[model samples]
Target: MSDEQQVGIVLVSHSGPVAESVVELARGLAAGGVTAPVAPAGGLPNGGLGTSAELIGRAAASVDRGAGVAVLVDLGSAVLTVKSMLADGDELPENTRLVDAPFVEGAVAAVVTASAGGDLAAVEAAASEAYGYRKT
Candidate 1:
């Protein structure tokens, strides 16, 4: 269950399992350490490989807590789909943002920040900063 007081997160990807795995991985990375609401908007309603505006919208709404929603997407079409939704301005929540960050790294960062009671901007920054992560 979501905390309903922190920023929400949405993960968008071309593959259903991949997106779902990221959500599980992110939450596990938090390790019972976070209350951030994370939803996966992957593939299509029919389980095909593609992005769906409906899924994205529903995912965004699923996690909306009035704090805001930070969306992390994988690859091209996912980005395009999110961008289109944001442009429409009605398909998603009022404060939903398409975070410009790495998929897995950013999801971890975003979830942690949001669970820590960070606000919308703070969560977005944390996720965006994940792009600079170094494993070397």
Candidate 2:
């Protein structure tokens, strides 16, 4: 993909089986013409904490190009897990980014921002800002 094209959004959550929910949300965004990939963290029952981060990192690496990536998580545990994975020197691509996005609202905002062709930075900012809008 070109540098200007939206690459992908990674949703990191402690919620089990993140792919289904994340993909559904992505489909909603796609219906609005946003084609960015959505990668959800977390794994099945008995899976470890960092499973989601690993999955997200893999998805981010496959994006090839674009405005980079935006990562949104469900809670503090998910956030911490992602941070630890990145700090462990997993070697994510240069454009990948992690943001502290509020659970539901942040996901919605991130999806909308990304779908609108907004850059990763913009999407991250939107997700972060959404967290402060009403303080869920």
Candidate 3:
């Protein structure tokens, strides 16, 4: 990926202090030889209700500046929160895409795929594949 084409992965959850959980999962993926930047959502002191989306956007922007970004969020309110934030027409970059991947499995798969040097398409595909591995 180009210096301006940084790829970002987010693990969003309703649970407060999601960053810790995200780090744990990221660590697991890393142990398997996957390396990618993983950002968590929720429980920041000043973060608003839509903090997850905001954090995702910030992380993406940090890497790509104005390039397109991809974000993956967990279940429950996180989905709606992210959707609402993105739908508000805030100045998100043209390539920015906020994808709602399956909670646990998708996040893990996305992190793994990203860590393996997978591109945006590969990361998205891995997230979809994660659903297939869901335990019923």
Q: What are the RMSDs of all candidates, in order?
A: 2.4, 3.3, 3.4
Off by over 4 Å in 2: 1-4, 44-53
Candidate 3 wrong stretches, greater than 4 Å: 1-6, 44-53, 63-68, 91-93, 134-136
TM-score of each: 0.94, 0.75, 0.71
User: Would you give me the overall lDDT of model 2?
Assistant: 0.66
Query: What TM-score does model 3 achieve against the real structure?
Result: 0.71
Ranking by TM-score: 1, 2, 3
Top candidate on TM-score is: 1
Better TM-score candidate (2, 3)? 2
Clashing pairs in 2: 41-52, 42-52
Write model 1 residue lDDT over 38-135, tens digit each, in one string: 99999999999999999999999999989989999999899998998898769999988999999999999999999988988999899999878788
Query: Which model, 1 or 2, shows the larger lDDT?
Result: 1
Error of 3 at 29 (Å): 2.9
| Candidate 1 residue-wise lDDT at 21 | 99
